[model samples]
Structure formats: structure tokens, C-alpha cells
Target: MTRHAELVVPGGRYVLRRARIPGCFLHAPSAFGPADADGSFLVDLLIDNGLVADISAAGASMPADGPAIDLAGRQVWSTLLDVHTHLDKGQVIPRAVPDGTLEGGARATIADRQFWTEEDIAARMRFGLQCAYVHGVSMIRTHLDSHEHLAPRSFQVFRAMRDEWAGRIDLQAVGLAPLAVFRTDWGNRLADLVLQSGGVLGGVTDALGVYEGAGDAEMDRLLDAFLMAAAERGLDVDLHVDQTEALDPFALPRIAAAVLRTKFKGRVLCGHCVSLALQPDDVARETIARSVDAGLDFVTLPTPMIYLQDRKPGRTPRWRGVTLAQELLDAGLKVAIGGDNCRDAWFPFGDHDMVDTLHQSVRIFHLDQPFSRALAMAGPMASDIAGAGRHGRIAVGAPADMILLSARTLNEAMCRPQADRIVLRRGKRVMDPLPDYAELDALAGMPA
Candidate 1:
């Protein structure tokens, strides 16, 4: 009693019966539907990772016992993707620090962040990596925080992890430092070290507000130096451009012009452009358009953006706290969704689950209009923006990374996210259920 059997055809018609279970039978499509006379159907129609297949009647010759999952009515979608993230510096819940009125919050964030050690950071990075892989994330761009003296330790460990996981996951590591840190000569030297050590260039800048010894001019100068250094080394840019309501949207244009002037078009990325949320529609739209014109991709950190919104009323229209996602999409600019900080000094709470981030994105932007497009945002679209296309799609030539979701339908999967199995590198299943392609192929050959 096994489900192993092959389908045989007489060029006309045949019946397929359950291998072990005798009651059920495979029925051919009626004279009016889409199934062919031979009962073979397309496994994929658009060559876009759409999993489709044909069915036939179960015949007596089929295996007597076999597992069966009736796919008479089901929907399957391609895996999801998370383009921008900061896993290396994440997983440390920082405590607030003394910074005037917000001193408490700052001190708490820093203290909490300090609790994570090199081993803990590595473990957290691996966990985050696994979580993303399970959720169908084949590639990610994570900025590693290396500002304080502790950076050397974290970067060394994460660098080793990155090397170990290189073939399995496409990981891009960026170097991060606050604006004040970059003002010092040592900061400039460290920035070079990051680039030389296979790190993407750039980090967070305090262009709008200043910490105790930081100034606005220093922030701008730091950004200039960072961009200039990246250009000199032929590296790409990813900056924490704006993260609060205090900054003006004009700052993005300033960066955009500098990018154009430096000729780093299509190489710069700005995450958490939250200031655009506060700017007038016209101004925001124009700034975004110029960013596109200057080749700056935007990655919206929906989770943290929502968390940082002013709780006080009349602060600003229930600030979604996120930048204009739909607007960027409509303007034909590159837009991605990222898990900005997961238990890090900023925000300090996340699970590396990009689907959760997408759920937030879906809700904030009223993305119910066309769900597929929204899902695409969490996947290939973002991958394309971050220059990580090789691992995004599931096409034959593309990387064999994929995740099996628990849901049976596209909408169900998107609405109710679940991770059943995760495969990385080349069809190597890291999580449970494992690779069943042999079983699937054997079943596909069953006689009907």
C-alpha cells in the first residue's frame, strides 16, 4: 500500500484512483472546462513562479496506499522578500539615556542594548536570519551598528557568520555610526575599515536634532564624508536619512543633489524617510520624485515608523509615522519595506518576521486595493531596489531559496502569515517537513 505510481495515457481517456484509499477517484474536467483531453494542465502560466499542475482520474493500476492532498481548489504564491534590514546591530533592546526631555527614553534604550554580548549578538543574528529565511527571505541588506567600541566585537562575529551563511543567504552588511561619531577623525578611519571589510557604506545621521555634543553642520559634513568615501571605494550607500517629525523633507533633496553631484546615482538608499510624512503633499511628492531622479531608493521601516509616532493628539493626523509608500510606488521610484530595528537601541522590539512588517504596511497604506502588488512590495520589488535580484524570484535559473507557508490561498497566506518550512542555498531544507520533491515526482507519475 503505497502512493508511488506513474500516470499512463492511451491518448484518449483514463481514470486515476487513490493508491491506498480505494474510495476516491480522479475526475477529468467536464467537456466545458479548461483541462485538456489528455487531462494535463499548466504548472505555471506566467513564468513568474506560479505553481500549477495537471490532474487525471485515479485508475486501478495506481499505488494502493499513498498520501493525498486534494488540490482541486487552492492557491499558491511565490515566497516573500525583505530587502532592507539591520540585523547585525539588532536584537539588543536598548534602554533610555539622558538626553534632555527624551533622556529617560534614550538612557533606557542604551542600557537595554548594552545587555547583548558578541555571542548573544551572533545568536540573535543567526536567529533573525533563520526567521527571515523561513518567511521566504532569500536576501537581505542589514546595517551593523559599529559606533561605540563594542562594534569591533560585534562586527568580527557577524562577519564570520556572514561568511558561513554566504552561499545560503545573500547578506549585505553596512557600517553604522551616529553623526557625532563620524565628526571625529577616528570615525572616518573606522568608516574605511568597514568598507574594506566587505561592508556597505553609510549609517544614521543626526541632521535634524543633535545629541549632547553633536551639531547639525557636523551631521551634514559626516553625510558628505560618508558619501564621498563610498564613491571613492566604489561602494553603495544606505543611510538612516530621517527618522522623526523634527526634520524637513528638504533634507532628502539635499542628499539627492549630493548624490547626483557625486555621481552615485542608483547606489544610494535612504531608510525611514519619516520626515516626508510630515511634509505637505506637494513638497513630499516633489522631494520623492527628485530622489528618484537622483537615483535614491527608499525603504520604509513601517514597524518602527508606526511605533515612533507622536502619541499626543493634534500632533499630526494620527501620523502613520511611515513615509508615503504608495506615493513612491506611483512615482515609479524604488521602494522597499524593512525590519529596521529588532530589539535594538532604536525601537527595540521586533521578530525578524517581514510578514508582520508587511501586515503593518498593508494596514497603514490601505493596501487592500490590489493585494498582489502589496505582497510584491514585501518581496521581489524590494529585492530589485536593493540590487539583490539573484535571490528573489523562484524561477528555474534563480536561487533555489523558498519557504512553504501554512496557508493554502494567497490572501489567506498574506492575511494570516505562517512559516511551515524554509529551504535555503540549493533545495536544502533547514527546517521541518524537508524536501519532498522525490515523493512529489513519484506521485506525479502515478497511473490514472
Candidate 2:
């Protein structure tokens, strides 16, 4: 209770100890076996069946000399939740990032990365899944492109991952089709394919931006058809909506209106409402208010948006492709940040950890200027914003999924994150750190 210790729990080592608790009612650590507020309580931890269930005081008290784990005062918060991601089709163009594009600099991304075999996807999923575990991302909603009628093959790979990792990670797969692909009736088969393949029903709106001709209206109709099919099948929806300078704020409002009318509000997640960033503050506020009022959850991809933005000189360039993250928070919207791409054509590099994504976001949004706030944001605050649920906290009933850090305080742990930060999927031991975050950093650009 007052020292550094690690006990073998599900998935990995269970490290527990004392620390200054964050000043939030929801985040206070609880005592085991009912004690005075002043006395410290045991914090049981484990990752099993894929969920983090920390049952320190369930029906028993700590034995006088039984097994114990001191987390070295490191915080044991709930596992992280990354509500938005595209693990299957990263970079939309993976091989071209480091080498730049054929046009001298980096080539612009049109569709997601292609030419990946099922083996390639499986390998990528392995890396992404493992990295996600270490970074405390216990849950992920990933979109996989089904553009070339690849859902049959791709879904097979994702299913294997889901079956293999089961409780280790809550993985949701979405079938993605570009608006152009949809209008040409290419996605028609893909939608039905995703339905049969048993994945989430999802699509992209910005793909509509690239539409050239009479294809535009037809694409809209296809999107509607896809949404309807998803609804008929009782599937949730996520869309890559309004992702360019050409996107109008009204476009998202229109979608929100449709969702409201269809009563599919909470089931719909609208990603990268980039148009919100271009609008006036009031207008942006009102637009999101309507969407949230209509029950649309939001997913912001800060890193990729920053990576893709035209940082060109002057001209009052108007596209950032990021939703109003902090502003949406201020509006009490259910919003979470996700790593949109890793080493893909869109973003040449991403370490695959939610912490990395969170770190970048803090810097981009000026959330880390104070330093101290940045550390806390990496854990508690990040969890809250990203729907870590009862996760991202060290409380009763929260998932036992946790990371054991090397530092005692929040600051030290973040400044030097470690693989020693044991990752627990539930109550089962999954991995022990022969190598940690240090090695992970050193071996950058490798698989995951």
C-alpha cells in the first residue's frame, strides 16, 4: 500500500501504490474493505476477458501478508478509449509517406492505402492492437475500406483479430466507401458485403467533395441507402463528414437533421466536422449544439488533421480538417480524439499510442502549456473526453485495465513513459516487459 510492487495479474503485471489523487470527485481512488477516509485501501487490478475490472474490495479485504502490489505512487486510472480510428487502411497510402510522393514532395491522398494483402492487414492489426494495449486504449472503433469489394477478405482478417483479442480489446469494424465509389454503385455491393461480413455500417462524406459530375447527387442517394441499410440491420453509424475547405457547415446540420428525423441520433458518430473549425465561433457553437442536441457523437482526429492541413503561406488558407475539439468540450458534447492514421499517406508517422495522440493534441491546442495540466490530461482528462467510460480512473467498478508507470507522480511518468508501464487487459496476465516504451520508441517505424 505504501511501496513499489508488481503482482502478476491478467495480461501483465499489476502495479499499485500511493499518489496524490486528482482533484475531481469522479477520479478519487477508493478504499478496500470499508475504512476511514484517512486509511489507504488495497486496489485490486487485472485485465481478463478483454475488460479491466479492478475489484480490490469486492467481498474480501487484503490479507495481512498476502500478495500485494505497490504502484510506486503511480496513478492507476481506467484504460484509455479511442473512439475514432482507421486501423485497417492507414495513410490511405502507406509506402509513399517516407519516400514522399511521385510529385517530388508527398503525394496527396485520395483513397486509403491499397494493395495490402490479408496477411498485411493482419500484421498491421497485430501491431496496432498491441500498441493500443500498451497505450491504454482498451476500446477502439476502426474503419476499414471496402472499396474494391474487399470486405469479404478484410472482414475475415478483422474477425480473426476480434476473436483472438476478444476481451483484450473491444474492437469495432466499419466498412468504409468513398462517396465516388458509392455513387458509381461500387459501394452498393460493399454495403451488403459488410452486412454479411458482420461489421459496422459507415461511410465518408468528404469523398463527395471530390465528385466531378452528375455523380454527386447519386452519391448522396447511395449514402442514404447505406444509412438505411445499416438501420434496417440495427447497426450503428459513423461517417467521415465535412472534411475539406469546400465543406459547408450546413452540410453537417443537414445530416444531423436527417439523423434526428430518423431517430438514429445516439447511434451516429460524425467524424471530423472540419467545417466547424472554419465557421465563426458562434456559428460553430450553434452548429455543434444542434448536432449534439440531435444525439450525434463526435470523433476528432487532431494529429492527422494537423498533418493534412495546408500550412501554405498566406491566402488565409481555410482548411484544417479538425473539428473544434476544446470548443466541443465546452459545449458538453460527447467527443473523443482518435489517431486517424499511422504511417499512412495522410500522416507519415504516428507512434500508435493514444498518449502520443493526446500529447500532440495538447501541443496543438495549447493544452500543455502549463506542463502539469498536460500530464493529467494524458490520463484522467483524456479518458473522460474519449469515453473511457468507468475506465480511465482508479475507482470501484472501473475496468481493471491499467498501465503501471515508472514514475510516482503524474509529471515523471509522462516525461518518460515506460514499457514497464505494465498493460493489463483484464484479470489475466498477457505481457511482461522484457522491452518497454523505450524500446518501442527506439524501434520506431516498425510494424505497429
Q: What is the TM-score of each candidate against the true structure?
A: 0.73, 0.75
lDDT of the candidates, in the order given: 0.57, 0.58
Candidate 2 regions off by >4 Å?
Answer: 1-15, 19-62, 91-94, 98-114, 180-188, 207-223, 247-250, 313-321, 368-399, 409-414, 427-448
- Looking at model 2, which ten-residue stretch has the lowest summed lDDT? 98-107
lDDT of 1 by residue, 1-448 (tens): 2211111211111112221110101123231134332222222211112221222233312233432322232232344556667676554432222221223344554564554566656766776776666555667777776666766776787678878777656777777766556557756676677766777766765442333334545445656776777777777877777666765424677778677766763378788887787887888877987877797787888876676655453455466778888888888887877877665545656676776777777778777565545666766677777776544454434533444334434455556655442233343334433222222122211232
Q: Give one clash count per candidate, in the order shown.
A: 45, 32
Query: What count of clashes does model 1 give?
Result: 45
Q: In lDDT terms, how accurate is model 2?
A: 0.58
